[model samples]
Structure formats: C-alpha cells, structure tokens
Target: MSALVARPFRLLGEGAVRAVRTALMQAVSAWTADWGLAPALVDVDVHRAWDGTSARALAWNHGAQSNGRRAWLAVGPDVATGLQQMMFPADPSYGPVGSATPALAAAGALQALDALLDALLRTSLSSQHNVPRCGAAVPATSWEYGSGALVARLAFGSRHFHVLLDGPAVQALVPPAAPLPALRAVDVAAGVADVPVSLRLQAGTARVGVGALLSLAPGDVIRLDKQADAPLTLASMSSHPLFHAYLGRCRDEVAVELVQSHTPVGEVQ
Candidate 1:
C-alpha cells in the first residue's frame, strides 16, 4: 500500500533483510564501541519516508559471477549527522572533529564508518553475507537526497541512520542465511555421546509408617506393591527423563528395554 512496497528487494525474505540489517548494526556498534560509546541495538525498521539533504551512495559490481551487477548503499543526512555527533565531540570551533555542517559531518562519518564496516565484512561477515561498500571516502558533495528511497532505520539510543538501497540492490548483495544454528552437529553428537548417562529403576513407591523405616535390619524383606508388567523409567544424572523401559535381561546381563519416548510434565519434547 506504499511506494516502498513496490521496491524490488522488499520481496527478499525477512531472513536476508535481517542479516543485512544485523551486519549494519554490528558495524555501527563496533565503530561506536571503539570510540568508547556503549551503544545498544534498539531496533531495525524498513522505512519509505526520507527527509534529509545529505546522502552517500556507492555503486559496485559483484565481480564476474554477477556479470558486473551493480548495487548501492545510501546514507541519509539526519542519520549521518547523528553519527557524527555521537562519534566525535561537538566542538563549535571546528578544531579536532572538523566542521559542523550536517552534509559534511554525515559524509565524513559515513566514510569512516564504511572503513570499519569493510573490516567487519572481511572478518565476521565475509562474502557469504554479500554486503557492499565503496573503496574510498565518499565526499559530502556526492550525496543525492530525494524521495521514493527505501531506507532502513538502525536505532541506538538517540542515534538513527537510514540505509537507502533499492530493491534490486538488496536482492543482489544480501545472501540467504542458514536456516539453523549451522554448527558442526556431528562434533556435538560425538561429544554428547561421551557424557556419562545414568538410569533409575523406581519399581514402586509407598508412604510407609515411620515405625517400618526405623525397624529395618538385616535379613528383612520389604514387599513393594508393584505390578510385574509395570515399566521402569530411565533418567539422566540431572533427573531429566530420557525414556520409559520395561524390565528384561539381555542373555546374561539384566536390562531394561526402552519402550517409549519420555516428555516431562509441561514439556513438548
């Protein structure tokens, strides 16, 4: 029902878009943390409205595999200005931090942030995620501000920046994230097997009289009201039920054959 709805990459599933947003947030947080700022990830939202004069966009080809496919990531003025203030001190004299203009601040801040993001992409994010960035520092004079722009709002405290990318740009750069935790399950399974397992055979239970407990001595037989067909419960050291089994013998050794899966009360599995 909006113009951004008509954009190309908006059709990319939430996972892909979320991965891109997460990468941006990580870059932003790392950049801020280096400056000694305790930035928190607040929210990431898709926005169609854009009201800013400063923007920095880069067009890059994703190598030969993409047949020279080009895409861009644009930054809005409000966001850039916010980052500039948060990143450096607000010196009115323009001494150490440079100028005070939003256009200049946004451009410079974005350029610096781009370098940090590049390093992150090389390290944690990598090519599998497919995020994009420009080679050199983008000048403030290069920004183009207009409408119909798709923006992503990365909010941290009072900081807010819009990542402007066309639908096609996102679809090209963003890669599909693995659908699961995606670690080495085989290693995990092998380690899990080595862990010690314990079993319990609570044949039956009774609320006996205190006199009966005190009278226990050698050569005394205590009869428990247990049916022979009743199953025994297998449990972990932590007392978590693993399975239900029936009493039996495997040739020479006594055994309790598993009969059914066990689920604790209020637990689905």
Candidate 2:
C-alpha cells in the first residue's frame, strides 16, 4: 500500500503580509492619482505557487537586493485591459475609434504598467527599516515562480485587476527584524541622585464647623485632636507618612527629630 504525505510549505508572517499589502496599496494609489484615477484595494492574498494560467501578462524582472536576489512582477491581462480603458476613455459619439485605438491603448498601458512597477518597487523597498537596497528593473520575457507568491486585487469603479509577485519578490518585501539592545546592570541610587523631591512635616490636624471657621477672630485658637507630646508625621509632598518625629528646637529654629520609621499598612516589619 502507498501512502500520500502533505508537503510542508513556508508562508509569510502576518506582519510581512500586511507590509506588502500596504506597500501595494500606496504604490497603486500614487500611480493612479498621477493619471487622475481613484482606485481602492479590494483584497490581498498569498498563493503557494502560480498556476501559469494567466495569459498575456506584462512582466518585469526586478532585484530586491544588491546581492543578486531577483524577483518578478506580473500584471494580469484583465489589469492591462482595465489600465487601457482607464488611460484612454472613448467617447460614446465616436464609439470604437478603429483598430489603431487598441494599439495605442496597449502602448499606453505598457508605459503605465512600467511606471506602476517602479512605484511598487520604490514603495516596498524604501518604507522598511533594515531592508536591503534594491536595483533597477528591466523588461522580463517570462516569470519564474517558486513556493509562494502574493496577489493583490484593486478596483477602479466596477472594474477589478490583479497585481502578482513571485516568491522572491514577496520575500524581499519583508524587512529584517531589528536587534534589541543589550541590558546591563544600572546603579539604582546613582540614576535618581539628581532628581529633586520635596519632604513635609505634619504637626497635627484640627476639625471645626464651617460656621466656627468663618467666625474665627485674630486671637482665636483651634485645638488639635493629637496630644501636645505626641510625635508628628514626617511625610512626602503627597502627605504619605514616612516617619514619626518629635518637635524640638535646633539653633533657635523649630524642627522635628525623626523618632521612628512609619511602616505603611500591609507591609512587613
């Protein structure tokens, strides 16, 4: 008995796919805008391999890197036709201006396709960090496909077209990951040595009715809730208590002597 095994294939990461889609959309938008056309990206997909079924495709050979890595771009027939119609809109009164019109339209479409490919290459290569520099493009007689490729669908009005990339091109569009910086031990005290912070001391607190507060005279005194001999709180600017202190006189100036550490609730002794 013979058993069949599924072949394993490598696919682009989600980030790479997203980057390719964005680059395509930007390139298409820029190209179409130059020709006074507005187009929207409909979808993007990655295929394991080209079926070699699409005929009359306009292709170009482009390098994704200076190290002889080659890639190919192909515009489907429908896309070429769409580009022709878009670049040369016919008047209804004239209605099919003759056989020469198709020839002219095809020529114009070819030029547009070349420009579009240039724009795509520029967008894909320039937008990424750590990506290898690409070389100039040349006219390709045929397309070579490998394990994977990318296909992006774009729509202008009701018409839709496809842009295809070979495996190398898809791989080229993916940027290399940037290396992370190495971690080293830092001096905790030295790092914050220059930072300024404010400390405060709390003598005591008193409560009184609003009426009594408003009726206070020049000599009026409010009794505090704490006893006179009780230690005051040494706190941060935000009033978070840090230590207990006792009132004292230092060089004819009133001061507080830190008596004990103030442990906050839920902390170990």
Candidate 3:
C-alpha cells in the first residue's frame, strides 16, 4: 500500500535538484579557468539519482590508457571514481573501481584541485570531512550531491586559515586574510616629583558582596589586586582597548601620544 502512494513532489524536487547540479557543473569548468587546465581535456558530466542526490564530474585532464580511461578535474561527487577523489579519498582505494576511459592522472588533477580547494574553502560553499586515514574529503558546494551525511562530513582542508566545514561557506573564493596589526601603547609616565597626591588616577571600582561592602569603614583601605604599575586603560564602547597612558601633567595639562600599546589603537588585540 505504501509503495502505491503518490510521490510526485519528491520526484519533482529531485529533477529540479539535478537541473541545478548541471548548472553548477558548468560553473565549475569556468571557475577552474584560472588553473589553466586544457578545456578540451575537461568534460563535465552529471549523474542524478531517484533520491535527491546528484554528482557532477569534470575531466580536467584525461587521456587514453593501456586498459581503461578516466576523467579528472576540480569537482566530482564520487571521490572514489572522481580523479581528485581517487588521489585523496576519505576511503581511499588507490587502484581501480569503476569504468575506464581517456582519463586524467589522478595525482596531477589533485594538484590543480588542491589549489582550487584552497580557494573554495576560503569561500562558503566548501566543506572538509575527515575520512579517517584516507586523507580529507574537501567537497565544494559545486560538488554537492544532496546528502546530509556528505555536508555534515566537512572539515578543514589545510592546516592554516579559518577554513572549516560548517562556518560561512560562500561560493565565491576570497583571498587569504592579512595579519592583524600589533598592539602599541602611547606615552606613559609614572610618579614624578611634586605630583598632586589627590590627583592619582583611579581604575573602575568593582562591586563586592553586601556583607563585604558594609564592613568597609572610613580610613579602611581595600587594596585592589590590580598592579600599581599596570598601564591605565581607556576602552571604547565596543570594549576594544583604545589607549593606555600614565597619569601626568604637562604644564597643567595631561597629554598622551604614540609610545607603546598593549594593542594598537582602534584595533582589537
């Protein structure tokens, strides 16, 4: 009875999904143009399933072989049969598994894919999945095959960079980020002769328990844990450190400028 039920929506959705996959496959070919791979050698193919899953293949560089042939390129769902997949698979099987044809060398195709992945990972459409000892599974959104298991498996491909599996996965690849500016303090001065004792700078007061507060009496000193030599900190509304300067007077006027900062002004340390 269940098998006889209508499943039109599922079928329609799967068809739409495959159409989108085909479009993305074309985009992959255009995207890899920077890799300078021969377009003639590359052939993008699409495989769709009754289930919502789909796979796209691009032959980056392929050629005839003694027995079989294969295609290679930047994007594919079947990492096993896909050139890049064969080279770096989550469940790596080095030899052969499926059909053969004029295929690209899995190793060389991977090198190109590696560069592209590095870029894709920087973007939002990419994800990395650790497939145990079989290396990493770096599948870009263009390589998406409509599986929650596949998406959940994304992990960081390279050791460096903020590239990750589930974070911002934008499709367009952006350049690597630059290093943050270092912190620097402005002019600072400590005690000097004849400075007004009552003019001593004060840090923000902290609240204590009711019992502790009531215990305080006139002439009773409560020494704070803050070090006396600690630079006076000025913070912006954003909680970012703006500057650090010692309390001092320059001809009856306090002044501060570039000296050294625990962190750069206007910059988060």
Q: How high is each candidate's TM-score?
A: 0.32, 0.41, 0.22
Q: How accurate is candidate 3 locally (lDDT)?
A: 0.37
By TM-score: ranked, best first: 2, 1, 3
lDDT of 2 by residue, 120-221 (tens): 655544433233324345323223333445555556545554455555566667777899999898976788778887879877789899999999999988
Residue-wise C-alpha lDDT for candidate 3, range 1-269, written one tens digit per residue: 46664311222233433433344344445545765544433333333222243222223221111111111223333432353443444544454557763255565655655554443332224223311112233334323333211111111222111112211221112234468998786533333434432212345466578998899899977766566666676555556555676555578787543245657444433
Worst 10 residues of 1 by lDDT: 59-68
Candidate 2 residue runs with Cα over 4 Å from true position: 1-11, 41-66, 76-78, 95-106, 121-172, 175-269
Q: Candidate 2: give its CA RMSD in angstroms.
A: 15.0
Determine which window of 10 residues in candidate 2 has minimal summed lDDT.
138-147
Q: Model 3 off-target regions past 4 Å? A: 1-9, 13-18, 51-109, 116-269
Report the number of the highest-TM-score candidate: 2
Q: What is the C-alpha lDDT of each candidate?
A: 0.52, 0.61, 0.37
Considering summed lDDT, which 10 consecutive residues are worst modelled in model 3?
A: 62-71
Give candidate 2's total backbone clashes.
Answer: 0
